[model samples]
Target: MGSPDPLEWDFSCPDWEQRLRDQRSLLPDLPLDEVEASRAVSIFDRLRLPDVPGQPAFADAAGDWARDMVRAIFGSLVDGERMVPELFELVPKKNAKTTNGAAIMVVALLMNLRPRAEFVLVGPTQEIADLAFQQASGIIDADPDGYLQKRFQVQEHVKTIVDRTNNARLKVKTFDLKVATGAKPAGVLIDELHLMAGMPHAARVIGQLRGGMIANPEAFLIFITTQSDEPPAGAFKAELDYARAVRDGRIPQGRVLPMLYEFPEAMQIAEEKPWRDPACWPMVLPNLGRSITVDRLKKEFRAAREKGEAEERRWASQHLNIEIGLALHSDRWIGADLWPRAVDVTLSYAELIARSEVIVAGIDGGGLDDLMGLGLIGRCRETKNWLGWGHAWAQPEVFDKRKEIAARLQDFADEGDLTVCEDPTEDIRGLADIIEELNTLGLLPAENAVGLDPQGVGALIDELSGRGIAEAQMIGIAQGFRLSSAVWGLERKLKDGTFVHAPQALMNWCVGNAKTEQRGNAVLITKQTAGKAKIDPLIAMFNAVSLMGRNPVAEGDNNGGLDRYLERLSA
Candidate 1:
């Protein structure tokens, strides 16, 4: 490979190359003599731009940053003695992130320290991983010189291995429990982590690769994704927490560096001229001007804003990194008129308590690897408006505290609100114990039920019936996925200025963190794609709807009404 003629382009002037050099210097101010500046310059020189049909060309700063990051990653990996895994998690959306990360993976495979290194590119699904593979192959096809094609060989039906003559043998695999069992991955790139749902399974698979990475401590495990859910927990949340710790100096220094690009939690877009909100694109997106045009984003996100759901609007804002009122991904479902400003609410919990004659409580249980949420919804008989109400949360660790849980249940019941609690735990023994304790305390309301997650707790269902708690409902099922009566009810209530929530941090989090997934006949509701999509709210919403005896007529309701459905838990 020969260097391009200096006269051909003006790198001598204040162009991308100079910008790359400046960014490279932003490193911990390490001594220039020791750093591989020449090698860094070389990698930047080879950085290629793929053909994106309509988008503006990548910004120079973005190109420079990508080049600098790749160089730094390589430099860190090559050092045999000083090897630490570095994480590159960014929030930049589709255009810039995917294209850039794909380029980095291709280059890493093409030019690596190990000859025929076994590299794995993993995603939640095969199709997603294939997209990356196609990009890499396209780069080879688009290579001006026949370098990549000549170097790499494709054995017709067999594996398409990278050229061993050079140094890298790249292999790609999607995250599968069965397939990933015994494999040793030299380098692994995880994409769209926001879509991952099951943590324990993912953790086990990732753990298996640890022993294999010993040879090359520089062996990378790169996670690249856009922000989907709020953290303080979950895999992504844990990652965000650690990254923040590193930035804030909470955790003693280590090399698992994190780069987060998100709008601050405080910024809010006004009802009028919401598109003008800058909270959509914070410091995280450097390719704002070039790759992701504001005009294009405005057009794309405009429909989602019409969903008429505050929760959905918050989701569009957080995930798309844009303000509400623009189009949303699920345009028709999310109505824009929902979500009255906070100022509209005049009554506090105290006033609501004084006036509320009837109250119904909904407790969404967070079992192992899930979040438990308690929402106290009160109904005004005259107005038929479910008053904006109180709520609480018990972290996953506290699920075992039956006494405390029962007491809290009793407390809500005494307030004439504890009508139903959804216990979506696989451990029916534990949930039964909580119900038994509540019953013993006489805290159980005259008409109340518990929603059990039927999918995983079938065996325990029979046992619950034998114990006379046959009314425990099975949750995390049916239409409540994302478009349930409960969700729409909440949406309608929010829109019409009726539903009231106490503004608890976790509940707001649960609301903001939720996302929609389309299933064949029914839509599955999920909260934050941690390792895989979690149906915390599916169970929660079922409990909320089933207990209040307030099932709205949505598409997915079965023949059994809410009470009849709960009665069949044991049957």
Candidate 2:
């Protein structure tokens, strides 16, 4: 790949309203079977809702929003066949996604022309699968008339619903490779696809399911999910991104139609934050008058805000369809909460050096399976504000050891925040070269400018020492509670919008992974507290903050002495 762009684009859809209209438009002109579509909607409407107040049928309890979504998903058929083989529906929580999946699968069974066909209902776990099966069975049991009972049989022990006459069976199973090994299902419904995204076999399982669906030409697969609580990753991210592109008209819809319940980019990123306004909550909450209520959601949102920033974010992501970009862990460093706001993508490594009176650095060591992080903090020559840049290096083993985050690591690599080195010594040499170049520049302070963790500083020190960088330039930043001042100081800078960093996804991930603990009145952030999630880059930044917090000044020629050290870097 070529050099990554130093300028980060804050993309907001200016034609969001038009795009939204196109996405949710009913395909009325398709070669659809009007009778079958009407019949399917009728069947869906007759399905009983036992849990809802008054135990009304779906027609009585469901709002127009749900009825439309159900119609768009299940009833649209071309030449008596399903129009789209696959549909992705990303809705907020409490929209009855699972129940809707069940209802549509029942409609598919009733209207299906194929005999002895298979239908699949998949969930991320057995517990989730069981709950979906319960909903399916409950809908069946709620029918006061004997028609549905005589027409179909629901076996609770096996979590199977069978159509008696057609011998078509719908089997509920957790998402697993073995689930789709041999079956050719007439229709498949996947509930909470976001949860299954993290599964190692999610892609393979989905591939197998798609293959199974291909065996039945008229079959359809529906994926119903809510936004992930955390930043999107893995198979979920892939599909979500693709679906969004299609919804935005960046790509042809082809066989997949995405019905995503999300705020327009303008509302989501607007300075006013209209998404957070209680009056605008109904825009995303399709079930506002039915299963969901505006006042109830407002009350819950207020309670979540009182809990903590993390809880508030979680509540927003779940109920308001607000995308989560920050740390949701209650113990996450406070700096992480404001990290997005402090993003100055225009701040590059060269820009940081060019605009700074002095620049200090930090280094954090990691094992073969982890990243070596370098963070630079430059105090702006004019504004006196600290501008930060971060980079991480990792051995190839990181992919093997942390396979779950390998995709995200590759994303960081693409974004130029990380480098995957062929050799461990190569990473050290890279760090030493950047430091040597910094020292040659006038911005790096002559003494106590580089703060490093002492645990594994030998290799870097040896390389830098050979280059004539004095040992006095490197100071060991105390870990744990002792570095509390730097930790707190960085938070203050970020909160007041002074500490600016090159908006890197790597930094965001590290910030989200970071967890802070109060130790004897000091806030301590440690890798040990972050569990397996890598926070080396963030730790290194705090280390740099510790050194910069001392207000060191460079003695070298500030303008012309050193060559561009960062032009070699991708960013």
Which model scores highest in TM-score? 2
TM-score of each: 0.56, 0.83
**lDDT, candidate 2, 294-362, per-residue tens:** 888888988998997789878888887787776558777888767888889698877887788788999
Which segments of model 1 are wrong by more than 4 Å?
A: 1-34, 50-62, 77-84, 154-161, 198-200, 229-241, 268-282, 303-571
Worst 10 residues of 2 by lDDT: 3-12
In order, the Cα lDDT scores of the candidates are: 0.47, 0.79
Candidate 1, residues 1-571, lDDT tens digits: the string is 1332222211111122233223222233221222554564454355455565432222342445465456556655333422335565655565356566666676666556666577766766777766666655665565566676787764323224576476566555566675366555567777776555324355456556656666665577777777653222234444555565654446544445454444333333455643335343424445556666767656655654565444455555454543332222332234223432422236544444334434433445445544344344445435655554434333434334442233223333333333333453433454455444333323234444444343444555565566655352323334345336555556666676765544333333334334555566554454433223223433454456554554322111222222342354437
Q: Give candidate 2 regions above 4 Å deviation.
A: 1-36, 50-55, 73-83, 143-145, 182-186, 253-255, 269-273, 348-359, 379-384, 394-416, 419-449, 463-473, 550-571
Could you give me the TM-score of model 2 versus the true structure? 0.83
Task: Tell me each candidate's RMSD, in Å, in order.
Answer: 13.3, 6.4
